[model samples]
Target: MSSPAPPSGAAPTPSLLRPWPQFLDLSALSLPISLSEATYRLTQNLRYFLPNYVVITLLIFLVTLVSRPLSLILFLCIFAAWIYLVFLRDEPLTILDYDIDQKIILGLLAVMTLVALLWTKVWLKLLISLIIGAVIVLIHGILRAPEDSMEDSPYGSLLNVVDSPGGEHASV
Candidate 1:
């Protein structure tokens, strides 16, 4: 026999096995308007936003990796600032005889990241890594030979020139 239908105007009871129906309402989690509309907007503009977000995230990761020690110090300072602002509210936050506020804490973190990037030479490290990767790729390509003759292969002449002594003067 089929179960009785729910009373009119009452929400249908969700099954215990499918609890997500009760808790994960997309409409409830929407910003100001409809969740579907917001999602549509994001999808429509993804091509414009994704590449910039990826580049910025990669740059931040590189800077953080290069400035490991200083980043740790900066993290600790931010943590201390948080602790002072939230946990130890009874005491005023003071640094170097000046009162420290949210703006000051944020400014300090920004300055620290900038200083760390400069001090660690993140740009120089990035350039070196790129050069090394290119060199490795080139070396691998040069060492791997094709079955075709030097004249038939596209890179054959270039490889021969590089491998041969006094072949620098060879015409293109």
Candidate 2:
């Protein structure tokens, strides 16, 4: 079965999933001419599409964990800790009157998360998925040409692309 075609005059609306439809423009994708060019394009694309890359990596990790219930629970606990201590915290935390540094919390969380995930034995699968995601992002970043048509803009970047009329530069 297939859906009916749209009217000829209608400019088909872009999918909500693709905030910036132009970001995935195939015509803009091409092989870099030189090592320097590749490096430059990779850096630029990575910067510009960092949010998109993050989502891809997250999706990969989530998929890897779906088959392992225990790992999923452990991952959620670790993620909650990070979110509570870092992103959601409005001020420095105090333990026994001595203030705890955010950096220390981050370090400890990183070490603990690694140890816990590794101990779960599912780390291998998650790690491989993450690496694959990184590779895909890197390849695309290197190949996607720097768009000449897009202009620099400060608003509607990353997750806020739809907020502005034309968020040309989601990243610099």
lDDT of 1 by residue, 64-103 (tens): 5555666556545644554446444543566898766756
Number of the predicted model whose lDDT against the real structure is largest = 2
Point out where model 2 deviates above 4 Å: 1-28, 87-99, 147-172
Give the least accurate 10-residue stretch of model 1, judged by summed lDDT: 14-23
Tens digit of per-residue lDDT, candidate 2, span 4-108: 777999753422223456677888898876786777788877766776676677668868888888888887788778767875666688899898998899899
Which segments of model 1 are wrong by more than 4 Å? 1-92, 95-98, 123-172
Clashing pairs in 2: none
In candidate 1 the C-alpha lDDT for residue 8 amounts to 98
**lDDT for residue 133 in candidate 2, whole number 0-100:** 97
Clashes of 2: 0
| Native-referenced Cα lDDT, model 1 | 0.47
